[model samples]
Target: MRVDVEYLEYLWPMRHYLITCGDFKGTANIIAVSFCMPVSKEPPMVACAIGKSAYSCGLIEQNGEFVVNVPPKELKRQIYYCGFHSGRFVNKFQESGLTAQTARSVKAPIIQECTAFLECQVTQAIDTGDKRLFIGTVLEAYADEDVHKGERIIEYAAGDFPRQVYGGRFA
Candidate 1:
């Protein structure tokens, strides 16, 4: 069965992550993203693909820092809210009821409700079609010991990807 190359996103089940970023003064934002992954382990580097028009994109560019928050299934509603709403007008932290905590390495705030957090500083930003891939060096990492005791991280698959393949399993 030949498949269209455009459907390549269905090849793998992507984990949903709440990426938080801001200027650390009054411009804080959170967005749900699945197009993020670890690119290196030795230096602890990770990359997240953000649309050029995304509100978080500009915030990240301005501060050169961000936090990757791994949320559990319970926060799925808040995750969707962040992804659909624009931060330019809405304060996601206040609306989602997610607490913003100061990160140790970066100015970006970590979501206290998340299961895990990765404080990162942007190492590079590469243009990739409609989205810019921001490669960040993880400066610090922390996680809830109890939540990670088993497979507890929430996963997501866009549109029909879940029905067409692996049923959106988590890693």
Candidate 2:
């Protein structure tokens, strides 16, 4: 069967994360992202695709830094909230009751509730017409002991895939 390119979102399940960014000494914002991945290893880098109009995109551009927080399946509601609402109007952390922990090398705060964090500094920005791809160098990476012991992190599939596909067993 031939598939419509526009409906290609079903091709694969994407992992969801809470990416935080802001000024060096100002308000911080969190946005849910599924289009993020590690692009390099030696100088470790990751690329995150964000809509140009997203508030967090502006913060990342201004600060040149961000934190990728790997959330667990339990935080699904919070993830949805961040993805659907605009951080420009609401404080996602406060509204979702997620704790923000100061990162070691970047100004952006990591979500304390997440299983792991990747603090990054922007190295490049690629324009893809509808979205901006920010390639960031990982300055620091750490994870909860449980995560090291094989705890599961969240993955989004728009409810198309079975939970087992993303609930750690497959990861």
Model 1: number of backbone collisions? 0
The CA-based lDDT of model 2 is what? 0.81
Pairs clashing in candidate 1?
Answer: none
* Model 2: lowest-lDDT 10 consecutive positions: 162-171
Taking the tens digit of each residue's C-alpha lDDT, what string does model 1 give over 1-171? 974444435555567789999955689899888889999999999999998999999999989998999887778788778988989989999899999888888888888888788999999999998789999999999887765675554443233343322232332
User: Candidate 2, which segments miss by more than 4 Å at Cα?
Assistant: 1-7, 151-171
lDDT of the structure predicted as candidate 1? 0.82
Q: Candidate 1, after superposition: displacement of residue 53 in Å?
A: 0.3
The TM-score between candidate 2 and the true structure equals 0.85
Tens-digit lDDT string for candidate 2 (1-171):
973343334545667888999843567889988789999998999999899999988888888989998888788888888988898899888899998888899888888888888999999999987789999999999988855776744443233433332233323
TM-score of 1: 0.84
Candidate closest to the true structure, highest TM-score: 2
